[model samples]
Target: MTISDILRDSDYSLDLLEKHIDDLTIFQKEQKSGLTPPYTVCKVRKKEIKLTPEEVVRQLYLIKLHKEYGYPYERMQLEFAVHFGREVKRADIVIMDKIQPTVPYIIIEVKKPKLKDGKDQLKSYCNSTGATMAIWTNGKEIVYYHRKDPNYFEPIPNIPSQNQSLKDILTERVSIDDLIKIDILKTQRRSLKNIILDMEDEVLANAGVDVFEEVFKLVFIKLFDELQNTRKLSTHLEFRNYGESDSELKVKIEEIFAKAKKQWGGIFNDDEKIRLTPSHLSVCVSSLQDVKLFNSNLDVIDDAFEYLVNKTSKGEKGQYFTPRYVIDMCVKMLNPQEEETMIDTASGSCGFPIHTVFEVWRKIYKDLGIEESHLFTAEKKHERALEYVREKVFGIDFDDKSVRVSRMLNIIAGDGHTNVLNLNSLDFSRWEETTKDESWQDIYFDGWRRLKKLRSDKNSDKSYEFDIVMANPPFAGDIKESRILHQYELGKNASGKFQTKVGRDILFIERNLEMLKSGGRMAVVLPQGRFNNSSDKYIRDFIATKCRILAVVGLHGNVFKPHTGTKTSVLFVQKWDEKLCPKKDDYPIFFATMQKSSKDNSGDKIYVKNSDGSNRLDSHDHLIVEHDLYNHDGITQDGIAEAFLEFAKKEGLSFASGKCESPFDEAKYKALLDGLEVIEINFSEVLIDKNIRFEAEFYNSKIGLSDNFLYGDDIIDFV
Candidate 1:
C-alpha cells in the first residue's frame, strides 16, 4: 500500500504529530460510490507553506539538526492555529523508528504536495511531543530532524531506507571504526614479509640483478674459457686493466654488448631471447638494476659474483619525484579509472601511477563497498586486483632507474606488472629503418613497443585515449646530445627546435604533445617564463592551436623548497578538437584570481599572480591569503594560478599590458609647436575619478589651479 494511503486511513491517530504541525493545507476529493469509510478531503490553508516540495524537503532536514552542527533549523518556533511564536515549517512524512505511538517517543509532520504549512505544523508538533527526532518529506526527498535538547528539534541527515527499522537508524549513528575493525593501511604495513618476498621475486625476474648477473657471469666465464682453448686473442685480453683507463672500460663494455647482441639473434624481436658475454656481464654490473638493488638494505643478499651492474643506461635520465599532494591534484583532475590505461611520458618516480592506485582503491573499496580486506593481499584481494598492474598502467621514461624504481614501487603497492620502459623517447630507430644508425636502438625499441601498446586501438575502450597526462619536465633543461631532436624535420626550421643551446625543457613539451592523442588532457609543471617569454612563441602557439587550456596554477616559490628556487607554473590543458576553439575576434581572455581566505601570524597569505598581472586580492603587498587547496580548486601557493586557468577557458587572450603610447613623440611635438601658437599651463593636481584624485601640490601652488586644464594642444615650452 502507498504511504499516503496508510497515513490517511481513518484508523490512524495523528496525536504523534500534534505540536509540530503548524497548518494543515487539506484538499477535498469527491466521494465515489465505491469509496471506503476514510474520506477527509477538507481544504486547509496556512502560512509558511509557500515553499515548493524540494524546498520543503530541504527545510525539514534542517528542522531536526542540532544547533552546533552545520545546518540547524529547530530554533525557530512552530506556528499553530493559536499563534504561539514565529513558525518554521517542514513538509511530508517522518520516520520515527525509535519512538512508540502509545508512549509518544517522537512525532513527525506530513504534508501533501500542495500543502505549504507542513514545516510549521511539524515544528508545533515537535514542541508538543518533546521528542528528540522529527521528519518531513514530499515522497521524492525526505528530511530528518533531531532535538539536541527538549526545546529544539535539530535537523539531521535523512538516511536512505528500504524498511524503517530501528537497527538501520542506530547503524547511521555508529562510528566508522565501529563498523569495520580492520585497519587496511595497518594490515598492508604488517604484510612486510609478503611485500619483501614479492620484491625479491620481481628483482630476480625483472630488475632481479642476482639471477641475470649469475647468468651473465656464467656466460662470461664460459666465453673466456672457450677463447683460452681456441687461442682466439681471448676477449679478456682486451681490458684486464680495470682501474687505469675509463675509456678502455667504456670500449670494452660496448664491445661486450655488441658480442652479446650477436650471440642473441641479431636484432631485438618480439621473441623473449637474450644472450650474454663477458662484456654483457660487465655491462649488467653497471646497469641501474645492480646499483639500486645492491645498495638496498632490505635484508636480501647481494651476490656480486654474479656481475653486479648499476649503470643508468641510455635515456635513463634522472627525474625528481613530484610530491604526493601535487600528484593528488593532478591525478584527481585526470581521474583515471581501472578501465582506463594511463601513460606518463616523463613518468618520474611513478607518483601519478601510485596515486592512480590509491584513487582506484578508494573507489573500489569506499565507493563500491568492495571491502577494505579485498584491497588487502588476502586471498580474495589478489584476484580482484591482479590484472591492475600490467595492462592497466603504463609509464615511460628515458631513465632506466626510473623504470626499475617505478616498476618496483607499483609491485610493492600491490599491482605486480607495472608497464614501465627505459629508453630515449627521442629515438625513432625502432619504428623506421633509417634510424638504425642510432647507438641505442635496442633501448629505444623497448620504449617504442611500450608506447605503441599504450596508444593501440585494442586498448581504446579500456580507458580514454590518454585521458590524463601529467609531468614536470626539466626546467631550462638543455639537450645538447639528444639523438631524438637530431632526426626531426620540424626541428630543422623551428627556432626552439634542435638547438643544443635551447633548453631540453622546450623539447620535452613538444614530445609530451606527440605522446598525447588528440583531445587528451594534460597538466604539466613548467617554468614561469613559458607563460610570457617571446622566445616561447612556437610552443605557446602550438598549445593554443592544439589544446584548450583549462587553468594555470601559479605556485609560490616555496612549493619547490629544498629544490631549486625556480618559480613554477602548472598549465592545465586538454587537447581540443577544432570545433571547441573560440570564434575569431572574441574579446581578450579574462582570468579570475583566486586568493587565500585566511593568514598565519606572519600575515602572509600565499597568493599566485595570473599571467595578465591582475589579482583577486584585497592587497597583494601588505596582506596575503591562502585558499583551501584541493585538486578541485586548482590550489597554488600563489593566488594567481586559479585566475590564469579561468582566463584560458574563456577567450584566447594575452594577459600582457598593451604598450603605452610614447609620451615624448619628439617629431610630432615639434611639428605641432611650429605650426600654431601654443600656451602652457602647469597643474599640481590630476583628478582620476569620483573620490580619487592625484595631485602634485608643489606644482599647483606655484601656478594657481584653474578650471581650464592643460592639454597637449595648448602646451608650449616653458620653465
Candidate 2:
C-alpha cells in the first residue's frame, strides 16, 4: 500500500496535514494573483487531498532519515490510524513493510497543541495494532514502547539517539548497537521527566527563584567582584523572579525555546509539552519538552543559572549558533581527526565543537566500530583514537554562560574535555592568564607565564606547535587606537605587543597563530572589511608572507541570524616558517566567492559533480535546510562548495608550480578563465556588470583617483 493510502486508512494526521495543504494552496494562489491572504483555518476533503508545505518538510526529514538508514519508501509504508474507540486519534506515523502491509514494525505518534496525549495515543495504538514497537515523539521528547507479549507493550531503554538523517542511519555512523547498549530508548519519558523536574526545582530555588539562587549569586559576586565594584549585576543587570501566573512570561520563554529548537535543527510539533511559569519561590521554568530536572547539584547550580540567565538575556542572537552546513564545510575541509588537537577560540554556542565531534565520531566509528562514551572519550570495548580529552579539543569564550553551555554541549557530544574558559580576547592579560594555568586559577592568576615561557625557550628557531585553530571573532572596531588593539595590529617596536586596530577580528587572527604550531592549518570567519580595506593591507601582507592563504571563501550576508547579519568570509590558512621564506609558487592563495546568480544560471545546478567527477550530492545535504539556503530546487542545496574546491585546487597548484608571487597579472589570468570575460572600465560609467569582481580595478572608484601622478596641478579630468 502507498504511504498516503496507508496513513489515510487509519489516522487523523493526514487530516491535519491536509488542513495545512489547503492553507498553502490558498497562499500560493494569492501570491499568483499578487494578493496577501489573511491567515485562516483551511479544510480539505479526502478526495481533494493536498500536502501542506509543512507536511512536505516533515516528510523530507523522514525521507532523509530513510536515506541514512538505506531504507527505501518502496519497502516501507507509513501507517496512521485511531486506537481505542474513544474517537481519539493516535499513531501519527507508522512504518511497515509494504509487502506485509498488515503488520507494522514501528508506530510513531506526534502530538501538537491540537492533538494532545501523543504519548497516550501511541500507547493505545500499539495495544490496538499489535505493532512490534511504537514511538510517541514530540521532537524533544520521545517514549519508546516494545511488545512484552502479543497484547501488552512495555518501555525499552537505551535506543541510540536518532541520527536525524537516513544516511547516518544506513551507514550506522552512530551505532544502533550502542544505542541499545546505552538504553537511550529507555531513557525517554521516565528518566527525562524526573531530570527535568529536579532541574526546574533547582533553577527555581536559585536566582531568588529556586533553592540554589543564593549559591549562584554568591559564586558570581565573588568571581566578578572587581567588575562588581565597577558594573555589578545589581547595577548593570537585574534579577527578577517573575511571580506566579505570569502567562505572558511563560509564553515568551516557550517562544524562545521553540525558535531555538527550530534553529538548532530540532523539530517540535504544536502538541509538544512545554511549561513556562515562575514557581512558588519565583524561579521560572520554560522548557520545550516536559518539566525535568536540568542536571543539577549545588556546585553546578551557579553554572546552570549563569547559562539560563545569559542564554535568556542574550537569547539566540547572542550565542550565534553557526549553521550546520557551514560547520560541515569547515569539518570537510579541515578533516579534523582524533590525533589533531582542535580549538575554537571564540566558540559562541559551541556549534563548531559539536559538529566537529560528530564528524570525528562518524569517521572513527565507521572505520573502527567505536562510539564516543563522552565528548573526547574512547570506549574500552573497542580500539579507538588517542586518549586525553584536553589534548584533543578546546574552546574559549568571553561569556561565562557561553563557557558553561559549551562545556555541557561538549559533554553531550561525548567529549569529556571541558576546557571552555571565560576571558575577553581584547584583554591580553586575561588571555595570557587563562591559557597558562592548567588549573585555570580564576581571575587572580598572573597572565604572563606563557609569554615568559615563550621568551625563555631555547629552540626559538625550531618546529611548529598546534595542529589547527578555528574561530569567528567579533567585528566592530576602528583602527586608530594602536595600544587598545595591540594584539591585532602589526608591531612598531621590537619589544612587546603587536600593533592593531580597536577591532576584535584581527586580534583573533594573531591569537589563533599563537595557539597554532608552525605549519599548522587554520580556518577563521572574517569580515569582508579585511579585503580591499587600506588599513588591512598590513594584515594581508603579513599573511601573504608568514602563512599560506590556502583558500578565501566569501559568504552571503545573513549567514548568521538576521539580527547579526554581516557580510563575512572564511579564510583558510596554513602557518609556515617565516625564516624559511618559501617561494611564492610554493603556496598560492585560493579565492572563492558565493554570489547571486540569475534564477536560470545557478552554480548549484552542477554542484553535485566534484573534481573527480563523482557525485558528492548523495551525502546528506544537512547544511542546506539547516542553514536556510534552499532555493526552489526541490533538493538539498550547496552552491558554495564547487567554487571553494576549485579555488583550493588552484591554490595547491600555484604552490606546487613555484610561481605564485607574480604581480597581479591580468593577462596571464585571462587565459586561465574558461570563456569568462574579465570586465574592466574606468569611473564615471553609468553601467556596471553584476559579475564584476570586488578586487578588480574598475570596481574601485579611487584606484586612479588623481588625474596625473607626476604633479598635483593636472588638467581637469574628463566628465
For residue 478, model 2's alpha carbon misses the true position, in angstroms, by 6.2
Query: How accurate locally, in lDDT, is each candidate?
Result: 0.40, 0.43
Query: How close is every model to the real structure, measured as TM-score?
Result: 0.39, 0.47
lDDT score at residue 573, model 2, on the 0-100 scale: 76
Which regions of candidate 1 are displaced past 4 Å? 1-318, 371-385, 430-451, 455-465, 481-483, 486-500, 578-628, 631-719
Q: Tell me, by TM-score, which candidate is best.
A: 2
Residue 376 deviation, candidate 1, in Å? 5.8
Candidate 2 Cα outliers beyond 4 Å, as residue runs? 1-287, 290-319, 369-388, 431-464, 477-488, 491-501, 578-581, 585-588, 595-639, 642-719
lDDT of 2 at 5: 31
Against the correct fold, how does model 2 do in TM-score?
0.47
lDDT of 1 at 172: 41
Best by lDDT: 2
For model 1, residues 1-719, the per-residue Cα lDDT tens digits are: 22233334222222222222233332323466653332222122213333333333323333333222322122222322222466444323332323353333334454433122444565565565454555554432233444444433333333324234323442342222221222111211112222222223323344424453343433332332223322333433231223323355445544554553344321222332333333333333222111111101111111121012222232223244554445665665455566655667677567776667666655555544665432132112344455655456666666554554454444445423446665455453443442244654443444345445655364332122565577777564556555555754335334544554446566666666656665566778877677655456556666666665555555545554433445565666666554433333212321111122233334223343344222232211111123423422223332232223232323332221112111333344334333222222121122122343333222114333333223222211110
lDDT of 2 by residue, 529-591 (tens): 675454566566666566766666666565654335566778887777543224343333444
Output the worst ten-in-a-row residue range by lDDT, candidate 2.
Answer: 710-719
